[model samples]
Target: MNRKVGLFFGTFNPIHTGHLIIANHMAEFSDLDEVWLVVTPHNPHKKKSSLLDNNHRLEMVYKACENYHKLKPSNIEFGLSQPNYTVNTLAHLQEKFPTNDFCLIMGEDNLKSFHKWKNHEVILENHEIYVYPRISSGEVKSELTDNPKITKINAPIVEISSTFIRNAIKEGKNIRPLLDREVWKFIDLMNFYKK
Candidate 1:
């Protein structure tokens, strides 16, 4: 009712089918109108070396999401400080786009560690959280009972991950179907993740 828009933040070292599916489903099944793929420049939880450059990752996300009208790739973190934090990004986005209501999109796996994020309480207070199921468990209601902004969605789950794709590429395996053909082609042409 508040012009819902989901902000799905991630490294997107390379955007894959699973990521796309969740975004599409969230928009369709939930109150969200669209989902933005906020491609992070750096994630505090992961090693910086393993991440492809932000531009490359952004390009892959662009190609992967080219066919989807509702899915957008944003380099919002490129202008922010390193080791981007969710709350800070949300605050900045809200200030810049005052009219749009943002919902945080995440998987059940990440929700387990969500409490540890920087100013995570501030995030729950400002945004709605939409989570998808994971292979490890069933749906988990928001752990923080006092926080009413959280909502878990019962959407279709796709177990694929970027880690597996990285491993496949490192092992010299085909990944054309695992990701968008354009994305796979771009990665192949650029020889990304070959090292």
Candidate 2:
């Protein structure tokens, strides 16, 4: 029998509570054996200047996921080419771990721009996509809404964003509530995001 694993891809700049909540929820309710947090070294859609070092980000994810037996922190994208594309990552993972059934875990907001991604159709055809709710302009719906491969989960809407946390930290504001306790401690100890 194939082990079902959900790929929760992100920069995880500092791995916050919101990310943990979503991954944990997906693992428990989505019939997934485990949720792997794939940390992207550089996302094609995001600015590189705003991101922390890949190793640092990976460490933060490790700290946040330490207690979660089902959540695994992955640095698989680190060896991949620059401007990491989701399709390529998924493809590589499938090749490397043939026995594992990989599923894509993302937020509803990503569905809005899903088509623009490289080889999105291939991704949809090969893997199941689990999308969680996000605070957006309107009720999040996608062209893939009718597709059985795409599963929309009513996960909690976490309004907190990595960008917001970074800004708050730079300004010396309290962002403890927005982060995992260990992650917050790591950030504070390393003086991350300080201007």
Candidate 3:
């Protein structure tokens, strides 16, 4: 069997401990052999002023996952076309890494709206999806919740958001506890999020 890798896609704009908790929990508790933290590229359509540069964000993810044996940082989406879709990324990753069986790691909240995603059906047909519970208001339909390819994992509900962290940093609040040591150091040294 190919190595089962869970792709946890995110912008990771200065990856925080919440992100690490979910990634680590998935790696340890799920059937996945490895969890790659895929750093999503900033959309060209959105104002780039608020989002950190892609390299900076990727570097933060790299630092955050440094000591975790099962965790890895991936910049696979960076090479893809702007405004890339998950289905396309899945296809490209499958083509490039045939030896690895990739799967999607998503939240229950996202699963509720999975139907609206571009080529959602194709994604479900090809890859397994590991859904983690979230403290969100919504009930997933039985169809999606019952999919054989979808597995619900008992991962912790991390409520931390990158937006909150950024805003706290701007206001000079100490958020070192919310982020990894190396990540905090890198961000402080670079003076990021301090508008």
Best by TM-score: 3
Please give each candidate's TM-score.
Answer: 0.89, 0.93, 0.98
Query: Rank by TM-score, descending?
Result: 3, 2, 1
Model 3's TM-score against the true structure: 0.98
| Clashing residue pairs in candidate 1 (N, C-alpha, C atoms within 3 angstroms) | none
* Best prediction by lDDT: 3
lDDT of 3 by residue, 112-139 (tens): 9998999999999999999999999988
What overall lDDT, based on C-alpha atoms, would model 3 receive against the true structure? 0.94
lDDT by residue (tens digit), candidate 1, 58-141: 999999889888888989888987666778888999998898998888887878788878988788877888878887754344
* Cα-based lDDT for every prediction: 0.83, 0.88, 0.94
Alpha-carbon shift of residue 133 in model 1 (angstroms): 0.8
Instruction: Kindly indicate the candidate among 1 and 3 with the higher TM-score.
Output: 3
lDDT score for candidate 2 against the true structure: 0.88
Shift in Å, residue 79, candidate 3 = 0.7
Q: Per-residue CA lDDT of candidate 2, range 29-54, in tens?
A: 88899999998786556666878898
Question: Model 2: runs farther than 4 Å from truth?
Answer: 43-47, 138-143
lDDT of 2 at 29: 82
Cα displacement (angstroms), candidate 2, residue 79, comes to: 0.1
Of 1 and 2, which scores higher on lDDT? 2
A best-first ranking of the candidates according to their lDDT comes to 3, 2, 1
